[model samples]
Target: MFLGDASTLLSVLNRRLPELGLVRYVCTETSWIESVLFWTDIRVGTSEIVLLQSNITVNYIKRKSDYVHEPISRTGLESIWRKMIELEILAMAFNPYEGMMAKISPTATPFPYRADNLWKIQSYVEDTRYGEKYFDGNFERSVEIKTRVGSGNFFRNEHSFPVKPYFNGQISKIASF
Candidate 1:
């Protein structure tokens, strides 16, 4: 999943698009800094130079980031998203090898979502500038379900689910199986 300046939005996109491919890069909007805070904190000296620098004192309210200074408008944002889809540059939210999609991870690690449900990354490959190569896993995943009784919702109570390692790259060693 490609992300932008908004981490909040990036998280949401990732969550919603778990089926997407690798999260390689991020396209951010604008970058912000504590310019106002920094400018406001500056103290002018009583020396002669103070007068010369007075003209340079910034308003402190508005400042721009060095790398990204412009904020794309909502319309522009939508346009960019549309363009990305048109270009087929974006896939979907990242499904870590341990969570939903394990068959794609290089490590061939099997992720357990529940006591009986499990997912394993059979195999995968990526085409990098260097070259296409195999991928691996380094995570674990599990899902828990709980039930409780209350006033508005009275019934029984239950909770269970603990993450545990289940699969390793045994498939990796085998060239073909």
Candidate 2:
């Protein structure tokens, strides 16, 4: 069983990791709560394993997310709704990161953008082949445009610490080698 967008990875695994004997996979469109439950079941080894095989055709899907620091006005919401209707957008998922997320210390994690972020607005467009074009008018052939614009080049511009190597005490061994 897999969640979200795992098609490419699954394909590569089926080709390269044949020794694992992965026969079939179930990819389901799940709600946030359902996704949480599914992962929880897998982590706790409570998931039921059943052998089922069938071809699964997934609909065209596009996802765009943005962090919101302030509330939208009524007029702004109306305009957003009008644009969504024009584009035939399927759904909008609003996830609040304020309560539990804000409680976590910034120094505790490598993710640095959690402190001031209030909510995450995720827009989904599904079932339409031209969904990507309609979802964001700026992209002509790819979603890379949107990513670059939103990312602010943080990974490239900012000073980042070596996470895994340093944390695992393998930096010295790696450097020596």
Candidate 3:
């Protein structure tokens, strides 16, 4: 999975996205875009436009603390926000008391979040195909990662992330090869 940002990746997905129907798997906490649209308070407007650009256009919207929504669960969350192709997706991660981050109250004055809009998740799936997630948006490619970062961070050059590879003790195994 080449990870970059949202817009950059969505552009690619729009270019030649795979053809597949789906079922969705997602955590209750993975309701980021939900708050943005449904919450009204977090809706994208003039000021919030930068948030959209950062979260989607740049692809920095991988996680709340600069992580990807893959390693935690296999919830097919993307399907929720946008009209997906009806593929079976599994989305996992923290909805609340499980993960490192905490869900913020909509009315909190100094809204604490890593990004302009916080959409935190660990992992998700599409049908049987899986996406082992992480917090940083470092997928197999740059375009996908960039789309989440959005245009604001992209233009301002603030789009960057530290990715902790899920080594799974393979490092020592690879040395023997």
User: Ranking by TM-score, best first?
Assistant: 2, 3, 1
Off by over 4 Å in 3: 1-61, 64-91, 97-109, 112-164, 167-177
Q: Say what the RMSD of model 3 is.
A: 20.3
Tens-digit lDDT track for model 1 on 67-87?
Answer: 222344779768756765665
Model 3 has an lDDT value of: 0.33
TM-score of each: 0.17, 0.39, 0.18
Q: Pick the candidate with the highest lDDT.
A: 2
Model 2 C-alpha lDDT per residue in residues 102-139, reported as the tens digit of each score:
88887888865577788777654321235334556533
lDDT of 3 by residue, 71-169 (tens): 423354444423222332222333332113344443664645433333544432221122315434334344344433332454354334312112221
User: Candidate 2 versus the native: TM-score?
Assistant: 0.39
What are the per-model C-alpha RMSD values against the true structure? 24.5, 19.4, 20.3
